[model samples]
Target: MAVVCSKADWFVTSCSTTLVALNRKQSGEPFVFDCSKAEKKPKESDGDNKSAGEGSEEKDSDRILAFAISASGKHVVLTDDHKRLVLFCTEPSWKCISTRWVVRRCTSLAFTQAEDEVFVADKSGDVYSFSILEPQKVGELKLGHLSMLLDVTLSPDDKYIITADRDEKIRVSFRRSPYNIQAFCLGHTEFVSSLLVPAGHPDWLLSGSGDGTVKVWHYETGRRLHSVDLRKFGLDSENTEKRFAVSRIISSPDGQHVAVQCEGFPSVQLFAVDCGTEGLLNPADTLTLPLSPWDVTFDSQNQLWVLLESEDMNVLLYQHFEQHWRLCDSECPELKRITDALQTQWHLFKDSVELESRFKHLYKVNFDNMASYLQKKQERLDMENKKRAAANGTKPNKKSKTESGAVPHSTS
Candidate 1:
């Protein structure tokens, strides 16, 4: 079994047979839940309305909350708490291809564009590159960072590997036979949270830091290009609170819009970068997603996918989020049902002395104008859901059929 504490005050656990979530005060007993309930249809009932046989367990149930896409975009990699990595497809028909186990905690993972190789980093600052086709170690890079590797990305040409460290450094190295250090990019004074290699940009490297700044570097020359001080944009500076961890940074496939995911309230900011000046100008758009999002991913259709732990990594699409948010705000009786259950679960583990006051504080009480918003949102979502359900037959969700505004490409 694997357990993780969530920001929403719940403990999520998963085993071979089930995924369970427990309120922090639930006396350490987790309530069994089904992750697939949000998706697939239930099994047909028996003659007397009885349930069918047990459901299959999630293959990657014990994996950490991280996500990975394959080089050819055909497969994805998932790693569990036990240090075992599983390879699967990117589609809903996820089929595991292979699995490997490491001796230490897995820090980061990357797959080559060819889908032929896989790279994994461990807490010990050692990176191992292996062949996905052959499933054998091909190369290993050792850096003396002493801290855990935070993120890793392969250059567009697949000839170099870049890794961010907890020590606030970006290490660049060649990817071939004599994989040696190319250069070290340094600027941030705190831990580097993430690294991105924008597609079609061979010389550019993007790094986000715990110091509340996102820096762009000239990878080959190790020259600092642009520094975006997130503090100036209203990020919390307190070290104890996670307000601006720069959890994720991703470039749209076309290399036009770069989406940066930050901690605290879980908002995604889309930025337009000017390559001529090598700096970030302003955000083209911004979206406030559900709170305490564990992972965010963009699908092949450019639609965003969010994974939350309300009941075992709830996967909600970005388009459905506004309506989903509305439901939790007001109107929907389901909101009351969810909150009541959560409160009861919390009180079960909390000290009764201050339970009443704590319940009022923890439970969501923001209902001012929420009712009006939910009313409007319900209509909008009903129209949308019906339209999508019609074409999709209640299966995969459909994105907007009409084209959106053109995204201007950013030059290298």
Candidate 2:
């Protein structure tokens, strides 16, 4: 997967195993870092060999789960499925500053507004705060939930830490006193997969869920403001039930527009931020994509950058202009360079285990579609049979005795 961090002055791209930082103006020496060489920190001594064995068995080796650059664009942090967290300094040199081990595999990473702390959320429902200023210090536990946390972010003012869990609960906790809960934004039927406090909307929250709805909420009052069902975009109840969760919801830098990407969908939904309509999200446009985006973000100029899930590792850019968004006329050279490097990496390891996994994923998708189609066909046949029976006025057959005391008519 290729991830791009587009800021005002520079853009950084991170493939599965490498990171490249390029300055937009200077085009100077690009800082390249091979993330595959990031060393994992040794696990703490539990004094139990059985527990150690269990942990080792569950660990996923060398798979990057999430990565993010700080708001200031000076620091970068990435977490892997093996429970390793690595922080990097992007300036002067692309150097790994620290490699810390976590208790469980991390699901999301967010940098604080001050850029002094990095918040890490793990599958075990715990959030840990790592002090970037004190690189030698280990991460300390901040707060936790009963369900697995899917995403976490801080309010614009940095006064509250909002977290979304797999149980459809979004909890807001005071940042200074995390133990004190502020409010709960509820109503999602399925897991709340993603959350965002859009720029300039400090009191509002936007969340996407497995239920196929993007809801707008008044976080401070815990009130449901409005919601837009993605099902309106051609998905039905059956399709939504097949676990197509909204993968990401991002607001543009200026906060005037928002983009939503759902799992298993190859198109991006765009909405305008309608503050006048009680903070509702108004439908703007939809950008049909060639492939499902692995990740999506908007640069300073409100150009949507989509990193595609493809063998070629392409990144598509769409510019917002004249109240509409459209693909750029020309390709970005910097993005092309990053994709070329990613393709090279893929070719060198085409026969590796990753290739096998990719094949398995593709097979699963095809198998699921075939199964769904067959199931629907069977359902249609059953409905038709019932209709036919009704039309024929068919009833249960009755058994009767014949004149010779023999059972002449019997129910089948």
Model 2's alpha-carbon lDDT is 0.76
Report the number of the highest-lDDT candidate.
2
Which ranges of candidate 1 are over 4 A from the true structure?
A: 1-65, 89-93, 136-144, 177-179, 237-243, 279-281, 308-412
**95-190 per-residue lDDT for model 1 (tens digits):** 456565554557678888777877887666777766678653434544435667778888878888888877787888877742478888998877
**Which residue pairs collide in model 1, if any?**
25-349, 63-80
lDDT of each: 0.56, 0.76
Clashes of 1: 2
lDDT (tens digit, per residue) of candidate 2 on 225-318: 9988898876454554455678789998888999998876778999999878777898999888886676788877777888776665466778
Residue 247, model 1: lDDT of: 70
lDDT of 2 at 357: 19
Stretch of 10 with least lDDT, candidate 1? 352-361
